[model samples]
Structures are given as C-alpha cells and as structure tokens.
Target: MTLPSGKWRLGFDIGGTFTDFVLHEGTTGALTLHKRLTTPQDPSEAALAGLDEILAMQGIGPGDLSEIIHGTTLVTNAVIERTGARTGLIATEGFGDILEMGTEQRYDIYDLFLPFPEPLVPRDLRLEVPERIDASGRVLAGLDEAALERAGAELVGAGCEAVAIAFLHSYANPAHERRAAAILRSAFPDLAVSVSSDVVAGIGEYRRTATAAANAYVQPLMHRYLGRIETALAARGFAGALRLMHSAGGLIPLETARDFPVRLLESGPAGGALATGLFGRAAGLSDMISFDMGGTTAKAALIEDGQAAIAPEIEAARVRRFTRGSGLPIRTPVIEMIEIGAGGGSIAAIDEVGLLKVGPRSAGSDPGPACYGLGGTEPTVTDAALVLGYYDPGFFLGGRMALDAGAARRAVARVADPLGLSVEEAALGIHKVVVENMAAAARVHIVERGRDPRDFAMVGFGGAGPAHAVAVARALGI
Candidate 1:
C-alpha cells in the first residue's frame, strides 16, 4: 500500500487517557497512526500536538489534509463532572415542578432511598411563566410576555450563563417555548438559550426537557470550544471541513454539534461500535460484541446483522452510577451500549466493610496510574497489571515513556496491607475484580436484549481491552 500519496483525511479521537490519530491517504491506501497521552488541562492542545506529530511522521503538513474528523469525551465529562456553565430554566406556571417529578415511573421498585439526579438548573433558578398549550398543538392561553421578560431578567440577574425554555406540550406546540426563547434572546442577546422542541420534539416531556437543559448547560462552552479549535486549526493551515462525530453513529458539522451538545454524550463509545461492525463484516462474522476499555471507563456494545444495536434513549450522570432513571434522561438515537466506571486508571481500594473494590473513580490522565510516576498514590488497574508482570518497564509505549516498577509495587502494596495479603496476591485480586466488573456489566447488557453471549465473537480494542480480553471472555462463558 506504499504508493504515491493522494489527498488526506485526518481523524482524531480524544479519550480519557489518550488522543489517537489516524492519517489516511485518499486513493493510495496508505495510513499512519499515532497515540499521545491526553492533556486534560485543554484537550485541544493534545489534539494539535498529536496532529503535528502525525504530520511529521507522514511527511505532510496541515494544508495537505482534505478534511478533519474529531471526537472527544469533553461534553460527557462536563455533564458527569458538573463543570458546565451555570444555567437557568423557564417552564409553564403549573408545570415547573416537572423538573423534579418525572414520568412517575420507578426505575428500581425495591430501593426506597433511590436518589434522583440533580437538575441542571436549581430550584431557585427555575422561573415559571403563565402559558398553556394543549397536547394537540393548540394554544389554550397566550404567552404572558411580561411574565416571560420577568423570568428572563431574573435569570440574567441570577448570573445564569445559559437558560433552557421548556413549555407544557412544547413537542406538540412549540409556539410558547419559541416565543419564550425569542423574548429572552431579545432581552439578552448574549445569553445561551435552548428550547426543548428544538432539541427533541418526538415525545416524553421529562426526557425532552432534560435533554434541552443538558444542551443549554453545555451550549456556550461547546460553542466556544469548537470555535477555539477552528481558529487553532486554521492557524496551522487547516482549511478543510471540520466535522465532529456524534452519538447516533455518524458525523455532523461543528455547528450542529455545538447546537445539540447533548447528542455528543456517547460519541466516543459510538465510534467503538461503528468500528466493531465494520470489522465483523470484514472478517465474515455474523454476530459480535465490542469491548472498549479506555482510561476512565469501559463500554460494551452488541452487533448483529452487520449493524450495531441502537437504543432510543440514555441516562446521563446517574447519581448511583448505573441505575436507570437515576440521571438526566435524553431521548436520542444511540448505538445501544453499557458503560461502567472501570478501566486502566480505575482506582482500587478497600470499601467501608474492608472489601477490595475496583473503581467508580478513575485517576484519569493527570496523575494517571502510579506506574506513570506522576504523583498518583492510589492503587489503579495499571499498577496491579504491572505488579502481575504483564508489562516490561523498558518497552511500554515503544519506550516513549518509562514505566516505574517500584512505584507500581508500592501502590499495589498499599492495597495489599489493608487486605492482609501479599502485593502479588492483592494485584491478582484487583485484576480479577476489574475483569469481573466488565464481564458482569457486559453480560447483563446482552441478556437484557435477549441474546446469547456464547454465540457472538468478541472483538476487543482500546488501551486495556485486549490485555484483559481472555479473562473477560472466560468470565462471560464466551
């Protein structure tokens, strides 16, 4: 495939721990790939750095690229970390409480103390306006313009950087929400605004409102982030279409992604699904499973009939982590998958009852694993793997960075001392727990969809997936 180069298509993916790059020659079938540690300080920097390095390797420049496709965990991380802009909500007078009371369906009937996820807009910031619309798209009462202005001004005065407008029956009749958004924009042209009907107009009030609120919360930030990337890429002589991969299994231009950032929530995981489906078909497989374990989390998806399964909706930032109805609901088409807080950087520690537990918390790329020697003290999956002699300290990452075996042993020993076991024993326990967690989650996801795991070929990718694939496959009886 080493022929004269044609036009180039460059792709970059920003995961929790690494930014991966792939450079493809249009007609020559040549490709160059690279992976660099992620810079959480500003993920764009990592993208640029990786791009430059890949260009140098390919003997090309930014101007030689015909297009750029980028995807990242930024929007999802904002929702999970609650790091987006301060946002307010505007609702119909009698229906403002919908922000708290959902469809009145219990996600878990046996758990009495199940907690609801916090609304993006707090109670004090949720203002109500007098308006009514029937389910049949007829306006029962005209919008209260004075009330709308008052709510907008109150939100502005409350220091809200963004606002969500969700009126009763807006999916059927968006007049009220549209007017409300217009009024707010006229009052404060700079405040980021989102209307429920504009985001999801199909059905389900709670899911629609929650999705719009989530979008508004991240709208300004996403807009600015994309703008920054555009400017930076332009400075590097990149003058091609800049597209972002969305959760629904395809790519959308930057503007579309900015308008509906909530749609980007599963973009990273969706890539894994798309790739698995392609690989399965290329390998003459009819059914398969994709396992992607990144730096912070692991995701699993089922594939059949040469397509990845898709779900109608998803929950974001669940308080209890994996329980349904415990987080903000978003009713968007998604390649159905299950995600768990277990990965290479997943922390291993003793629970309250002194039981060894793998993560719901990750060390991420910052102070990554203790083996990175970046000041991380917690015992993570990477440290456990090192202690188990799975890696050669001198050759990790092609020796781009050295691994610290002493630090890995010390970190695993920290967990070992509490469990009254040797470091090697504790490391084995941690490894088993990590693999079990992933297998258990994947099994539930497959079983719920009425499938047999043993019938599907497992396709594993990502930083840690291949390393632990055999253990996970055996645990799942595949």
Candidate 2:
C-alpha cells in the first residue's frame, strides 16, 4: 500500500470502552486528539464517527489525510468471549486432542481446580486424518486423501466458515499442511483456511496448532470488519493508504492482517508502548515501563533502550489472569506484557465467600458503567470512582455526556452494604483492590524479565491509566 501526498495523517485505536483518535498535520507538526464511546454492535460505526468529527472540527477533509493507521482489540476480545465465527481444526491422526491436552503441564501447581480457556475448535469439530510427519520433517506416512476428504465433508456439514490445518511437524516442513489446505479449499472455495506454517512457524505442537486455530477463528470476523471500515472511509472520499497496527508495535497492510488475524491480538496495547517509549527516549530516560488502562482491561509492558520486549509466544483468553500457561498459547510476534481484566468498566461484586472482588467481567460500552446512566445497573470501576469523588459527574466526557452520581452511589452500595461499609469506603476499597491487583501483576511482570520495578520510570496513558498510575507506582515503590 502507498500513501498519497497530503498534509494530514489520521490514526485511531478501537478499544472495548472507547475509541481514541490522533490527527497530525504534517505541515505544522500540530496534533489534535479525540475520544468517543465505542459502538459494540458495529465497531466501524464508532471509528467512522470519530474520524468524521475530528476531521470536520479540525477544518480538514478526507482528501487531506495521506495515511491512516488503525488498530483494535476486537480479535483478542472475540477469543475471550468465544464470539468468533464457527471454526474447525484438522490435525494429523491421533492428535485431535492436542488443543485440550496442551503440553500436560500445570500453570498453577497448587490450584487443583484450574480452569483452562476453552479451545477455539471443540473436540467434535477437530478432525483427524492419516498423515504423519516426524520431529525433523520426515514424512513417515503419506497424506490420506480419503480421510482428508471425509474430514472436509464433516467440517462443511458442521457449517464451519473457517478451517485450520495443522499437521504434525508442519513448522519444519509445511508440505502436508499445504496439501491439506489445498484439498479443503478445492472442496470449499469460500472457506477460510489457515495453515500452521503460514500463520506461525514454531516447534511446539500445541502452540503452533493453537495459533492456527485462532487465526481461523477470527479470520471471517476481521475480514468483514476491515472491509466495512474501508468502504466507509472510501465513501467519505478518503484515498489514503490504510494500514493496521500489529502486536509488535509495527504496521501491516490490510491483506496480511485479514489472513492472519492472530497477529493483531495485542495491536492496540502495543501502540501505547510505542508512544510511551518514544516520549521516554525524548526525555532521556533509561528504562521506561508503559501502562495502558482501557475500558475492558489494564496492561503493562517494559521498554528498555528504546525497544519494547517482544516474544514469539502469547497466551490469550486466560482463565486465571495472573497465572502463566492457563490460557491458549498462541505462537505469534507479540509485545511482551502482563494484562488483567481490571479496568474502568470492570464489574465489582461480592463472591460467595462474602469478599468483595473486581472483574474478569465488564459492562462494556453499550450500557457502560452505572454512572453512565445507559441502563447498566451493576457497579463498575467508573461508578466507584464517581462515588469516591474522583470524577465530576456533570463534566464527564468533557460535558458531552453527563454522569448520574445517584446511580453510581446506589451501584456501589450493593457491595458496600454487603460488607457494612460506607459507600465512599467501599469505593475507596474498590480502587485500592484494583490497584493492588495491577501492582502485584506489575511486580511479577517486571520480575520475570530480570528487572526490578524500582529501577524503571513508569508512564501511564490511555483513558484510565493516568487516574491510578500513582498508586500502582507507589505499590511498586517506583
């Protein structure tokens, strides 16, 4: 893709709670920012809405933008919510259970009842064929055409829109996988197929297989979303080159992003890290830790010497937030970071043990927080913040959207009354709990990288990041 010669560039990041924008005028190096509530029903709506408002307010038009870089957490959210398109997996014979078995190592040794994220492709949808390739890429048995065809028929019968092909040793030699994909595509030309080698090249069977499955799971959804966004932009006379932010704090074209949606999983969070790193370098800081708190979750990453730590493996949709190996291990190029389900819209409730706890659950943007007065009855971090006097109810969203303080107090009372604590006390408790949770996560996150939290300077961005950055930093003694 090529960018046209123009004086303006536009960028947007789509998050669970809000969509953020940045418009930069190349001529004067001036920048403008904007935010909008995310439209979950159709994410493109929020994106286009924000783009139009920003351009119009800044006295610019679509033709003035030479480039647009967009990123979204939709792919990762789909995996977490199990809301992607119907997907099926094809594996070598006797390996259909690889996704479930998952290396047989316990992520938490002491926690007996450990919960694992459900496999993207269920057991019944995972088909097997008579094909074998050894560890070093030796084909011990040839591909079984009849078995493959039978599996393809089963998948088609199951109404699978996407199929993932991950035969054993495909990373070393992708011959069998390529053949399987060809066979399936020939049978169903419209089916989206993701081969193991083409998605992620790795030696681990479970990681490679899971990665391919994730790509297939979200391929159809991402394809439709990107197509819709492009059409909307084009209708507005935008002729700029479109690019997507990736997990490694880099950009990729639309075609590559559509084919391998797995790489876009952490795209939005990576953008924060990159921006923080740049600002840190300009200030001549040695080690910078980036913190981004959005609507659905909070994330922290380490940047040293102007580079964010990246890994070839990432775990998605974790059952236990802080525990390692509890989620689907996707082998992709991802910026290394620790993420938790604690965020502004995270729901607060009392567990059966009569203890108050924050979320792995969220209210999202549709209803949003109770204070938003958008039909949400549950207490969220935003509501708690309102109760604790951290936000001006009348001036919320820069007065564009007013908040209801009475609703926020009532929502927080649910947790407060249960523990016989005052509403303000409960609200403060909620903030402390979430901050402690993030602080504990950050401590572990930095420790894993052979670094101390006190050794790094922290930079918090995003809508919710700045609000609690001080407490988190104090918790880490940074």
- 129-226 per-residue lDDT for model 2 (tens digits): 99888888898999998899899989989999999999999888899999888888898998999999999887889888999999999999999999
What's the C-alpha lDDT at position 203 in model 2?
Answer: 87
User: TM-scores of the models, in the given order?
Assistant: 0.97, 0.96
Query: Candidate 2 — which residues are off by over 4 angstroms?
Result: 1-4
Clashing pairs in 1: none
Query: What's the distance in Å from true for residue 386, model 2?
Result: 1.7
lDDT of each: 0.87, 0.90
Q: What tens digits encode model 1's per-residue C-alpha lDDT throughout 1-478?
A: 1333338889898998888889998887688888888998888888898899999987788888878988888888988999999999999887777878888887889989878888887889888889899889998999999989988998899899999998889899898888888888998999999999999997777888888889999998898888888998999887778888888789999889888888888888888889998999999997989899888898888899889877888888888777767778887888888884498999999999999999888998999999999999889998898889887788777677789999999999998997799999999999999898888888888888899899898888888888788889999899
Candidate with top lDDT is 2
- The TM-score that candidate 2 achieves is 0.96
The C-alpha stretches of model 1 lying farther than 4 A from their native spots are 1-6
